[model samples]
Target: MHDTGDAETTVILDNGGHNIKLGVVGAEGPRLIPNSIVKAKHEKKRVFVGHEQADCSEKFSLFYVRPIERGYVVNWDTQEQIWEKSFSKFDIEPTTSRIAYTDNNYLIPALPDVSNEIFFDKFGFQEVHKASASGFVADHAYKIRRERCACVVDSGFSWTTIACFVDGVLIQESVIRIDVGGKALTNKLKDWISYRQLNVSEETHVINECKEDVCFVAMDFEKSMIEAKKRFDENMIEKRYIMPDFQTSFRGQVKGIREPLASDAPSIVLGVERFAIPEILFNPSDIDIDQCGVAEAVVESITQSPEDLRAALSENIIVIGGSSCFPGYRDRLLQDVRSMLPAEFDVKVSENVANPETHAWQCAEKLLEYPAQVAWINRKEWDERGDSLEYSRFFRTTVTSDELKATTQEFEQKGEKSPKNGEEEEF
Candidate 1:
């Protein structure tokens, strides 16, 4: 590959399960494109990737082959196609630019090797740097003056992960994963709707939209349930969601709470399901998943950190991801966490209020502003070292959970104050 020298730009790709957030560093922001390579029944001969899926005139019977599964890129063939389309569509030259790719925090061991091979061997990129998505968010939070130490609750499509970062370095052992996410919530909503009102199991896309438009985390679960049972005309809890007729409207939209009109098409009344669907994040037992909820997971993760940093982690909690975009999610999470902690701990849960969908990507863009040459491995270096190259060298800034704990213990034994606060605190 030809080197573009210093003129070559940096590219940031937050490859998410639902959407691919791609943009050049120093650009305004990342552009979100559907990550699925789809084949529609109407046009079986053609395959669509990225924004190409939008051109499909027929909206019904669309089949999607998502490259990402359970927060990992499982299918490189489809992923490569999506990447190629994104590069071409965005006028980006992959071969000449430096690439920073965001992978899931609990990345599978083999995937990184595959990613390196693809970017270095097949795509012929000048350089590649891989980092956890949460790391970028932590760096972004620190850069934006949120806090140096933060607990990130990334509730994405496949899984909800709680990870702690001190000074932008991830605490490996403090990471917690809950298998509940937006996709599971969407599927639960579909199952409930199919069992009660209509069979929407086949209409995953429309049901997902309904969940996004109407679903919320209820602050008062029992009260919400009581309110859901009341008549729609008398109760404020019930709302009607009119399903779209794909022939005319390409996508379904929420029409708000209203009296049923004589000419109104097929519609479903969404009652407690609106809040209950998202409540699964807090109570996984609702779906038979024997795991702690997002808030509990956060507390659990923070507890695994050094004792002195727990208060700071609680105060600087950063909630991001598509699932976190739900109304009252942050408030509910704050309430839950606050109730579990002591009164002295200042609990502050903050979301990326400006742009929830591109939070990680925005963080990545900010991270690119710094000189991260040491974090990157060029094609020449990888080719020379081959299998002998230490992959851990790329993430030299990160610290394992055990390392963090051990260092903190040593400091405590030495009677020295924590790194952030040199002065010791009275118990």
Candidate 2:
């Protein structure tokens, strides 16, 4: 690792599809901001950015225009607007300050170009460093667990990906991704709710909140389904979700299993959908997504690594991102991975559910200590080399645009709306 020695302000951003995590390298933690520009139907002609109207408790249809789609930046104009709104808080001197960005591996061969044009040409930033959403997880693990080899299972908004690293360097060949994540689960929950209860097709924002407040992963799929069928007081898996009136509350609440509610209050009786929703991560085929489940992908990723590092990677599987925050996610994933691996291989899965989505931001903040290793592109360097990326310093993966395109098509075909980055991070 090489240090630049110059103390330029490096803004660390863990840009996810649902939220953007922003902070300075030395700050205690990242500040999370909603990543979309929302246009509420009631507030006609007025647009809100960075959650300006997010807390406006009212009944309205939210039409969002996000810059990112399927873990990549597709509409740079909208992205620029969001970034402009977010950048106001940082007191940054673009000519001198630096940017540390992470996204879906930046393997598209064109992301760096677009990013440079924006940060350098438009935003006037002096330097920019980019990495994958999972680029720094290996290094972060090594720092805490002293584990030089790790397999990172990042289950975020756009999708879940499994990547293996040996000695903190990515094994490009050992990368596998499945199109199952928070957004998928949220939409699934919304569909189930609409089918069994009320229609919430336009209430995406509320439905998402409904999911966060009530959903959980099932440790045993069969047992949980059986438990979900039990009567209210007798059911251990059942819960009452009280929907916000928008007049008093902005988000829904998950009450006790037998909690009483006002007769007029809007509520949903959550049952098998809670566990069944998250189960898609373990069996994407359940949603008709033609990809292996998260655990299967993890095993596939590790088995593709060098034979010697497989054991080390197995013992250091670190799971992060938004979807991984679900209750019972770690235990279920650990059990599934252990069951699929060879009998002699010992499997260990680690999770920090408190704030799993911030792990990438934390790791990116640590990468600031080694500017040379990260390959910061200053203005002068950008002028000389144009917008081309140095693939050698950048992380590369076998996951392709075709795979991503297929994933996008599958979701859209199923009537699932696209969400911004993760637990996919960004610029």
Candidate 3:
């Protein structure tokens, strides 16, 4: 950990599929901006980015084109547009500030090249460091109490991943990814609502809002399902969500169960959909995906690590990201993980109650208080070495793409099939 006192300013960017959390490193908190460029059905000519999207007159039927897909930045042009807005709106001078950006661990193979092109060649930043957001969270844990071993369950918009960190370094072999996330949950809810009440397949923006406002993980799945099946009037599970007029409210509001009225605007009665959507994270097989759930993924990921570190990892499980904000999620995950583990080994799961979605950004800010010159590359160094600069200096993972490829090939040749559709398998 080299001292970075010479750097005048530091900027932290916790880029996610749904929202981009960014601000000056030392600021009290980070500002969350929409990570996509959106186009509303009512407003065709005007494109909304970041906070501008919130100002759209009609949020319903809004179509979004995001730079990130499946947690990886695939479209640089759109990503650049979003970044430009964020930087300008935040009054950040890229060339003068040291930038720290978060990338998904699975995308590390391509991130270095893309990151170099963007921050160094394009924006001309003074210095840049790229690391997984989970790595930063783990580092923050180590910073506060010197906790070295932990498992991170990051349930974001595009995917939910389980990663293990030992001594602030991520163990690549102990990483597992489940394709179920907020977007999938939203889509599932949309399908359920469309099948039962209204056709909302195209109303992604509205459906997503509904999910955030009402969805929760069920502590007891069977009992919740029983309650969901009761009559709307007698059922405690049912809640009426008043659809936004768009002309006035611009966003829908969740109302208590009520009788239909002529004056009442369009609405949907939400019941099982609330817990059913999030249930996919606990049981991916419900949606026909063969991958294990978050708790199972955590267990599988920890099994890949050294025997001595397993207990520490299980005892320090940290859940983060927007999806983790759902009510009962933390408790339910803890229950499931606990049931799967031996009674002798204590299992503890924790989440940031105040700002779980931006925990990574908060951790990144805390990380800046320590020495970090070794973790960042300056413009002079970038210009001299180009892509030859070792990414391990900035990234915590030491595993190479080629090495992983060879390992996968060896597994395949040995008649063991790799997980399909990029789903992670237990090592």
lDDT of 3 by residue, 341-374 (tens): 8776678885443577988887787777553633
Candidate 1 global TM-score: 0.90
Can you write out model 1's per-residue Cα lDDT over 126-235, one digit (the tens) per residue?
88777778878776666555466789888999888888987777776688889988889989998999999988877777888899989899998998898888874667
After superposing candidate 3 on the true structure, give the runs of residues whose Cα lies further than 4 Å from its correct spot.
1-6, 105-107, 110-112, 259-262, 351-353, 371-374, 398-427
Clashing pairs in model 3, backbone N/Cα/C closer than 3 A: none
Best by lDDT: 3
Candidate 2 lDDT by residue in tens digits, 124-199: 8767777776767776555444555678888888778888875566777787877677877878887888899988
Which window of ten consecutive residues has the lowest lDDT sum in model 1? Answer: 418-427
**Whole-structure CA lDDT of model 3:** 0.79
Instruction: Tell me the lDDT of candidate 2.
Output: 0.73
For candidate 1, give the lDDT of residue 40.
76
**What's the lDDT for all of these models?**
0.78, 0.73, 0.79
305, model 3: CA deviation in Å?
1.1
